[model samples]
Target: MLSAEEIHEIEAEAQHYPTREAVLIDALRIVQSHRGWVSDDALRDLAEFLHMTEADLDGVASFYNLIYRKPVGRHVIHLCDSISCWIEGYAGVRRALAARLGVDFGETTKDGRFTFLPIVCLGCCDRAPAMLVDGELHVHLTPDNIAGALEKYA
Candidate 1:
């Protein structure tokens, strides 16, 4: 069930938009900020509040990469898979993370410390081979520095 606080926050955000649908993304974000990820129940409740169908809201959630449908670990690591990142040693970074965390993309660590996922880009081609750990971008990564970079989050 959506909390009265969650509903109130969503309604408050909706006030800035012309329509409820316009607030859909922010509504999902609001829920995610509080709950970590948007579950099926939360999605349905949010959809009903916004007068949108569950399927419709689910579509919106699935379309956005940042909106995690399943539960994620405490930290989410978004490895860039863009052309620049791939060119600039993305393989080593991927391997390092897979080895260090013992989890592949879309999987969470056994200790529930981190979740690995691939992102198309972080808009930092200049700083290629980059990744975001809990929304903090780390750039210019190499195999050698990758472990140290992750340590900050650990």
Candidate 2:
């Protein structure tokens, strides 16, 4: 069941849209903000609350990579795999992250510290190799700096 606070926030955001369906993303975000990730039950509750079909809401949630449909670690690492990043040695960084975290893309560390995933871009082409760790953008990454960048998270 959706918490009273979650319902209140969703309702507040709903006022800005013409229909509840229009606020689907925001409603999902509200639920995720409180729960970290959207579970199947929460998805169903949200779909019903917004008068949307579960399939429709699920499609939207899955389409948006930021909306995690399953459990995630405390931190999410979104490594950019754009051509610019690739040119700047994204491979080495990926290797370093995988080695250090012991998890590949789309997988979370066993310690529940970080979930690593690849992103199409981070919009820092000039910086080349870049990543967003727990929403903080890290640019000009090299294999050597991965540890320093992640040390603060724990």
Candidate 3:
């Protein structure tokens, strides 16, 4: 499942650990890099590699939003529907994003290029209606701005 180069990199990183278990995070990252997300089979392989139980490794992956347990679209657009963003004007932003992506929240585009998810906050309360695209935050969102900015990604 891994190439010689990837195995070399993985082993190099694993070597730094006093215990192979210490490499769980790095292993998960490598797996994600190769597969774009962590599948059950991948996590099991990761568990075996780390000398840990699947549940143990899975707990860590599931706790972090950065790790994708399920298949996701190519681009993940997390729109902040937090109280602050809502008070400002998140509805319009949400609508714009949904329309631009041609999929509703928690859905992948038919072409599998984009997905929409709602986030509680981006910690940019001052910039309400803020949203994140591929982990990059954008502030002061409007329908026009959101639609215009998403053209290239679409």
Candidate 4:
């Protein structure tokens, strides 16, 4: 359940949107920022708060790729897997990094410091073989760059 203050805060966000329905995404984002994924209770609360049905809220949330409906790693490492990246060395780079980290894609490290995921396009096709770690983009990556890059967050 959301705190009274939290609900009030969300109400302010709700007002900013042209319609209460518009607040659904942002409110769910707020919930995810706090709790990781969109839990059943959070979905129900969001539905009630936004005057939406649970199914309606779920539908919108599921439609968006960025919205995590399940648990994600504390530090998400998104590697670009688009055509440009594939033409580069992203495949080998991804494999080597996974070997070094000892976790498959979408799996979190035991220390919980990292989780590897794939991104369809980083929007930097020119910098094919790029990745985003903790929201910071690292372009033109190689296997050699992985350890040093991981150090920045460590």
lDDT: which candidate is best? 2
Give per-residue lDDT, candidate 2, residue 31.
Answer: 96
Which of 2 and 4 is ahead in lDDT?
A: 2
Candidate 4 per-residue lDDT over residues 1-154, each given as its tens digit = 7767667767888888788788887888788877777888889988877778999999998998778887777778888888899999999889988998889887988988788888888889888799999779998889887888888776
Q: How large is the C-alpha RMSD of every model relative to the true structure?
A: 1.4, 1.0, 2.4, 1.9
Stronger candidate by lDDT (1 vs 4): 1
Give the per-residue Cα lDDT of candidate 1 at 32: 96
Any idea how many clashes model 2 has? 0
| Candidate 4 deviant stretches above 4 angstroms | 4-9
Clashing pairs in 2: none
lDDT tens readout by residue for model 1, 11-129: 89889988779999999999998898999988988988888899999999999999999999989999999999999999988998899899999999998899999999889999898
lDDT against the true structure, per candidate, is 0.91, 0.93, 0.81, 0.83
Residue-pair clashes per candidate:
0, 0, 0, 0
Task: Give candidate 1 regions above 4 Å deviation.
Answer: none
Determine the C-alpha RMSD for candidate 1 after optimal superposition of all C-alphas: 1.4
The digit string of per-residue lDDT tens for model 3 on 50-89 reads 6789899989999876788888888788898889999999
